[model samples]
Target: MLICQLSDLHIRPAGQRYQGVADSNRMLGDAVRHVQALDVRPDLVVLTGDLVDHGHPDEYAYARELLAALTIPYLVMPGNHDDRDRLRAAFADHAYLPATGPLHYCIDTYPVRLVALDSTVPGQHHGALDAAGLSWLKATLAQDTVKPTIVMLHHPPFVSGIPYMDAYRFLDAAPLAEVVGAFRNIEAVLCGHVHRPMFRRWAGTVVCACPSTTTEIALRLAPDAKPASFMGPPACMLHRWDPAEGLVSHISYIGDFEGPYDFY
Candidate 1:
C-alpha cells in the first residue's frame, strides 16, 4: 500500500497569506495538483494537521475547497492551530472521524491499519495524550497484533534537534512510547508538527515526521538556533509498505523539478 503524508498546510482565508508572506492556500493547491499528477497516485493520503492557520470557519471552508481537487481519498487530523469543532464540522462527511471526543480513530480499509491519535492539547501550542487517549491507543493497537499498524498524530513524540520545536514536542510522549514499544505489529509512527521532514528510530518503530506543503522550519542544529521558517521547496512524504520491504519512506517535493533523465 502507498500512503502519502501531507502536513502543516496552514491554510488561511482566501486571498490571505500566512505570516504576511507565505501563500499557504496557493502552496496547498499546488501540492494537491502535484499529488494528482503523480505517475502512480497514492492509495490514500493522510493529512497530519495544521490544516488551517486560524482554524476559522472561512479557513476551513477554503481549505476544503482546495483539497477537493484531490481525486484520491484523504484523511485529516487536527493540530495545535486547529479548532476541533470547526475541523470536525468541516470534514463531517468523512465517516472515519469519530462523532465526539478527540479526533482519533482507525482506518482499516487498506492492508495496513492506520491508527490515528489526537495529540493536540486544547488551547496550547504543545501536545499531549491524556490517560484516556493513551488507553484508547493501547486498546486499539491490541485489537490486531498481526496486522501492520501505523500510528498517526500531529506532534512528534520525540524531540527534534530544532530547539524551538522541541520545546513544544509531545509532553506525555513517554506513555505513548511505552504502549507503542510493547506492540510488535506497530510498523511506524507518522507525524508532522515540526514542519520539516525527519525520521528517528523510536519505540521499536520508525517515527517519521513529514514536511509541510507550505513553508518549512529552518534546519537549525545549535542550542540557540533562532526560531524561524524558510520557503524551502514544499514537499510531502510517501510511505510504501510491502510484505518483504516492510515500510519505506521517500520525500517527494511538490511542483516540477529537473527531469529524471537517463544517465548518459
Candidate 2:
C-alpha cells in the first residue's frame, strides 16, 4: 500500500500569507496536485497536523476547499495551532472523529491499521498525550497485536536535535514508550510539528516526522540557535508498505524542477 503524508499546511484565509511570506494555500494546493499526478497514486493521504494557520472558522473553510482537490481519501488530526471543536466540525463528514472529545481514531482501510492519536495541548505550543489519550491508544493497539499498525500524531515522541523545536517536543514519552515498546506490530509512529523531515528509531519502531508543505524550519542544531524558517522546496513523504519489506518512505518534492538526466 502507498500512503502519502502531508504535514503542516498552515492554511490561512484567502489573500493571507503565513508569517507574511509563505503562500500556504497555494503551496498546499500544489502539494495536492503533485500527489494527484503521481504515477502511482497514494491509496490514502494522511495530513499529520497544522492544517490551518490559526484555529479560525474561515481558515478551516479555506482548507476544506483546498483539500477537496485531492483524489484519494485523506485523514487529519489536530495540532497545537488547531482548535478541536473547529477541526471536528470542519471535517464532520469523517465519522471516525468523535463528536465530542479528543479527535483520536482508528482506521481499518488497508492491510495496515492506522491509529491516530491527538497530542495537542489546548492554548499551548508544546504537546502531550494525556491519560485519556494513552488509555485509548493502549486499548486500540491491543485489539490486533499481530496486524501491521501505524500510529499518527502531531507531536513526535522523541526529541529532534533542532533545539528550538525540541523545546516544545512531546512531554509524556515515558508512558507512551512503555505502551509502544510492548507492541511489536506498530511499524511506525508518524508525526509532524517540527516543520522538518526527520526519522528516529524508538522502542523497536520507527518515528517519522514529516516536513511542512509550506516552509521548512532551518536545521540548526546548536544549543542556543534561534528559531528560523525558510521558503525551500515544499515536500511530502510517501510511505510504501509490504508484508516482507515493512515500510519505506520517500520524499516527493512539490513543483517542477530539473529533470532526472542520465548519469553517463
Candidate 2, backbone clash total = 0
lDDT of 2 by residue, 1-264 (tens): 999999999999999999889999999989999999999989999999999989999999999999989979999999999999999999999999999889999998699999999899999988898888889899999999999999999999888888989888997699999988999999899999998889999988999989899999998999999999999679999999999999998888888987778884
lDDT of every model, 2 decimals: 0.92, 0.92
Q: Which stretches of candidate 2 lie over 4 Å from their true place?
A: none
User: Candidate 2 at 125: error in angstroms?
Assistant: 1.0
Residue lDDT tens for model 1, 8-30: 99999999999889999999989
Clashing pairs in 1: none
Per-structure clash totals for the candidates:
0, 0
